[model samples]
Target: MKPFKACSCRDPETKKLLGKQCPNISKKGHGGWYARYEAPKSADGKRRQPRIGPFDTERECKAELARVLGTAAQPKAHDERKTTFGEYLERRYAWRRSEAETGEGLKKSTLDAEREAIDLYGKPGLGHIKVVDLTDEHFRELYAAMRKLNRPDEKDDRSEILRRLKEARATRDGRRLHSRPISEGRIRRVHAVLHGALTDAVKLSKIRPDNPTDGVWRSKGGKRKQGRAKPLLWTSERVEAWEKTGTVPAKVMVWTSEQTGAFLDFAEATEERLYPAFHLDAYYGPRRGELVGAEEKDLSLERKRLHILQAQSDDELDDTKTEAGYRQIPLDDESVRVLRAWHKQKLRERLQWGETYRDAGRVFCYEDGSALKAEYLSSRFRILLDRYANIRAKAAEGWPADRIARKFRTTEAAVAAALQRPLPPIRFHDLRHGAATMLLAAGVPIKFVSEILGHASVAFTMDVYAVVADEMAEDATRRIAAFIPRQNRLSAVGASTVPSGG
Candidate 1:
């Protein structure tokens, strides 16, 4: 029998073979083995090539054609200079992220609004304009479109596609509407990010002349400014609640922070049996990578010290966050106990996994005998929080469910949000303050507290946790308790005697 073969099909129109049309192919082989595609041209005659692939059989030809019909597509290379402003913004936006992981050029998150502005206004208004020809007016149109993320009328999802078809959109951060019709504050963050990217691009001379984001502060109506960032420092009530419940996922984090003694100052913590790993972070603030990177071999048991011997990311091993992240942290007897436990747990896991595991010489591992990603743990922490709070605080705090669904990797969004929770009216770091208060009440010297908390100077230690309102209230009660006058003092010409300071 002959090898299987199929004949070509032809279009009824003028009997031209359907396969030979220049719908977009750059070149087609005479032997029927290959086809090269050029970009499609807009009405203005500027063309861009987006899709290119090689098929082993004709069965794939129709499938490739179907993919091109559906919406949501990237601009072809040929349309590089003629695509919408939104196209440029999206491309640059992705570029920055890819660069950041590699430790390459300027990296940031300010492209969100720039991207939205382009999607919302810039591309419609001036995307067709040559990249070399962008100007202040184009920026204004882009800004105008971005304003919609905040505004309701501008938010009509139905007109989303139509509204984006302008050659007059612009983006700006202050009170001005990005594209008018936009009216909300929740989206200001995206705008802020976008503007930052445009500004940096301007500095790099990637885009010509001035940046459209110049002078733009993330704001709405030049007034309703974006909220300030605040750290989500755990509080005593919250901590005590966790200790009592002992079921919250964040409990480990809180316990770990307190137990680390790297930062905790509660006198009871000095009981000498508990590990105080928290002090290490309180003093050093090791990024998750640096902290999780610690391993058994990195410790000197006799000296009671932990060293940052190795660190890594999905990409490759790196020195700590900076040269300074590489340091030897002295441990106390208590801290040693905790670390030793964690070390034993890890060693057991490694041995169980044996040669089947992806080895990274890490100190932190999962109960499953595998390396635990820091991000995954963060997610678990949130879950444990939700369950512990009976789902009350989670909803009240407005965490993203979709986000929490994934494991904790140290994403900027998670980190920023984790750091953005509101602080108490007094010292926001009251957990630290409470710890210090406990330490001071037990007569731990200010100098020792300073060393444990990792403050380079003693004055800082004294200034922060020494003046608690509750402590003052206690002192008031003690001072008001006065005894009967001293008989000897009366003989000395005093009817009543009190301490000189009193």
Candidate 2:
């Protein structure tokens, strides 16, 4: 490859490139220099010769040539530079697959989530941009666009949604009139996936000099402004708002102690088959995966201990999500009693199944002793909540208890014993939040709560439940004030009226 001058100077009649053959080729301003070279082999093992540019002087062309040559010389660097972000993600790279698939890396679920994020937001927004040319601004723009992205309605078909999006793009006002906007938290997760991929590219392949994502703040004002949503207690005002609008204030909402008790009472009265599981979840806050993954040997009713050594994701049982998740949790007396009763019931079930029982040995299982899926547990919880909610609503309307139970396929006795107060809707995972809140409210040490919940750090546990901690602080002050005998003490607002006994 070499750098040389060329021109458009051509024969008047022929109208073809003259190169050095033109009459005006010797003129100072006749032509510019060009850097010409054969590019490195592509991923398919093919190389192509190319002309890059025409410069006023040979020096500029030579400089360009040097840079191109240098990049091409580095192993795989030229290919990466030519590769778009979308192409890189789609390629069968070693770093992209799960450990199970390749004997080394991310879990299949985690990888699937990453690919989904990339396809949904990353590919549409910046996938066409070359990995080598990616800048912080590109990522910032993508995140900004994602923050404004609206969630499609359940009834909105894909093609209709696409048409609306296309129309929005063509309109003067680009706002998407859809359902609620996608949460900033979810966008941040998408950011995390892209950022991780870029980081891996830089470290493992040297595809880019540095990760552009590193320069982009997760949100406009940083993490403090994009704070995590703490689990808010379903206070009366929030509950009232939810009942009227069918909307909860925050993503994470916890039931109060009274509400938790009401739910447990309802579940027990209904003779819910999974009452023991619900009790354990509400009391200990094990993740849904952990709850469904619990083996029969993991529970020690006599010792009041439940070991969370593994967790289920879909139907696959594996190690817990994190190292801290493998810790043993102390069970309360009530939880122990519930499990003991459940164990006896399971014994009777085993006898009934006899030789044909699936014998999954799970703490919670189907009637045939097959393992219960995490999703099934969540679905069942929702059904229970719906029935409980409906029955309670009818009871408030002066309907007979037996009639209400019959309508919802629950027991007449259960309906009769149901608490009049409404049980606010919450995700099954919120039971975990409620457990943490109850522990914090009951004055359990934050460290203990962290351990019980299998949080990686006490600091994180404190940060998540900081609101609960603040309330606890206020309660402490009130209790201390009431405990102290301060009749002659100075008032809080002003000095004491009575003279001090000097």
Candidate 3:
């Protein structure tokens, strides 16, 4: 080919481009596939050293060029194997994606996420680095890079950054791109992916003694500042206001959230064809979807118990949140009243529209007496928020449905928005927390609260319930005040009479 230079022209299609030199490559962005060149770009009259790549960053560009030119500069620690991080990732990605044709663990959502992560952080930050070279230090670097690459602006999150992270982590890009810090959950995922890949590399004799990620990280929740870990909740006054008017969406949402305990409870409580949905959730706490998908007869009124047999989730009507989510709960008085009212109401609806009601026979139904969908309930919750804009205005507050949607989780948001704005606002899920705190204040056991929240371990419940437990300590002094000994009995408790061990 004619000597390549700033102005020298070649068929854009014919000239092979490497890394940043590709016309299609984004300057600060990433795009479709391009291969590494086997030789450096020719520098016209200058007798020169190798030109790594057209990349802006010399480190990554030069390293990639070393891989293309010869085996001489391969990984110093594992040079005999002759591999680089980027090359390994490319290969692994191809293999995992190829599994889709064979119908393996291929999922559209996952693939889409991986593609987005690559586009933002690129394969270099994730898959291309050497396995043996990876260290906890490297993970910190990767996480920092990832953080730099995206904005935590609520809008950016809505744009799918988290989804992409999920996909990227599942695949080889499992390493953190920036050490700027990430959630423990995100870091854990990266460690898992790294360990898996490195373990395989070791088994295949591609590396030495161990998977470097081993014991480097212990899994935990996200450390990133995504507001807070706790869910939000509304206040009682706001809830009562909405209940009185039956017009404001915020008030309606507030009532449902507090009354139900969680969003799932609201969904259950409001289920039409599946009447008495809340009976199951309020007492046992199945998800809104689980309640929505339940049959009219799923719960046994005569048995005075509800069965959490299965759950309809974000995916399918598969297994519930876990085995813990599938248990029987005896109805409390309130649960019984609500369930009976709903059942009786549903029976009247059925009489009014027999054939229509028989269609799904879902206990949770719409005005038409047809089974209700989770999305419909979610929408109704929103409608309630909009209808009460005046009430929200009067309270110097407003709903945040759009804001909630960006989080990829919203029932919690609705419940939170329903709360009247306090001195410092409270999140909807905070209602559940408030309930737990109240229970703790009331001397209820941690194990009981944990079971209500559907936590698998009591220790986990206690750890999360720590703050509420402290509230109980405050009451300790108050409770002990009643037992303070009488003044007459205190005369014998003089300091001189008490033996001093010291």
Candidate 4:
């Protein structure tokens, strides 16, 4: 293709064409110079002319003409159907949803998370860019934008702050309200969604063969350096601090052994219907979802084993988080007893409700037999812990009988008796961590802990519970030293110097 030419309008008064012959054009100065080019035909084979600019000089117009011609000469293969990144993401999500419905793709929870990431980060940051035009620089810009969103500056806009405050008041319960920065883990999840979408685009030939995200730097050099915070054990010091400040360290907080026992005891005493579920979680480290998803048919009371074939997400039972999460977990005698008691309790409820009872076959359920919502259980667990804390505080202060009784909704005698003990508060999922730590501390093999926890691999288990493992290693060192008798060591050294039997 030849470079397009530039021309300028004539002087209005003179009414003469200001072509190359104009005296002003020789001086390289002109007014209203415009570049015109014969543009490429449309896909429908219609001819068209495209104009670029109204530069004051012929040289400037010519440069613009050259750039436009160059761009037109190398048309994008998929330019016929230009798709924005946002549009592609929507299409990709629909395809994924279709595959999930057909049992060929992501789990509902996984898909929901991806959709959230796309809407919150992907669409807002890089959505307008064409998939074929996405570059490493664009991804870098996207990451920078995401980091800004992660820890957005306190909203300076009064209207926005008022809106958020209104929302807070609407949802406010006794729970404290605070803004939390989007964690590194959440940013990584968003990146994963973007990477997955780009990968799919490449496979479908919607974009270039290479995925731009493949080479993009993660928010903090990948999740290994800035991933989810590890679960923190509720040691005595942490418990004391928490009791004083009411601030729990790390979201995933594990209870100490004493606290775990105290929670189990309190749950049982309070007639919590899901005590058995909590019991299993504390002893076996099954996820909250797995505990809620437990079915009576999958339990072998005689064998003391529970099959973790699935997990509860929202109100629906679905496949376990991974294939490895489908393994069987052995139950202790106490766990078996608790489950047996819960089973008998369930049967009696079923009998009482009779025809009205909804038999979902879940090992844990409401008295009416409907499936338990995972969110309800989590919230209820927190509420129960709060109640337990209040009761303990009242008892500690030596409150009079009637006040304690009225506060706890129990007899004064019961309140007085319960005052002798107190339990530290912890999140429900922390029960799983407590179980893993207890097992590891008690000299259970890491492999067994891994299998019991349904972790994908022992390495993952080790990584998560490395603190406990280090403690166990120190204990082992001391025990080994104790086992090697001083006399025996001395005898061996003397024997070595004395020479062989020959």
| Most lDDT-accurate candidate | 2
Question: Which tens-of-lDDT digit does each residue in 249-349 have in candidate 1?
Answer: 33112222232232233211222211223344444344455555666578776898778755655334455544444567677676667667666766676
What lDDT tens digits, residue by residue, belong to model 4 across residues 47-109?
766665566655777776664554454334235226888898999899989999999998888
Ranking of models by lDDT: 2, 4, 3, 1
Instruction: Tell me model 3's lDDT, rounded to 2 decimals.
Output: 0.49
Candidate 1 stretches greater than 4 Å from native:
1-207, 224-285, 295-297, 308-324, 386-502
Candidate rank order under TM-score: 2, 4, 3, 1
Off by over 4 Å in 3: 1-141, 152-191, 203-297, 344-392, 395-449, 466-502
The clash count of every prediction, one per candidate, is: 58, 0, 50, 0
The better-scoring model by TM-score among 1 and 2 is 2
TM-score of 4: 0.73
TM-score of every prediction relative to native: 0.45, 0.74, 0.46, 0.73
Could you give the C-alpha RMSD of every candidate to the true structure, in order shown?
Answer: 17.9, 7.3, 14.2, 7.6
C-alpha local distance difference test of each model: 0.46, 0.77, 0.49, 0.72
lDDT of 3 by residue, 175-263 (tens): 44442445455544444555555666656534544465565553333333342343222344444564566433321121222333443
Measured by TM-score, how close is model 1 to the native structure?
Answer: 0.45
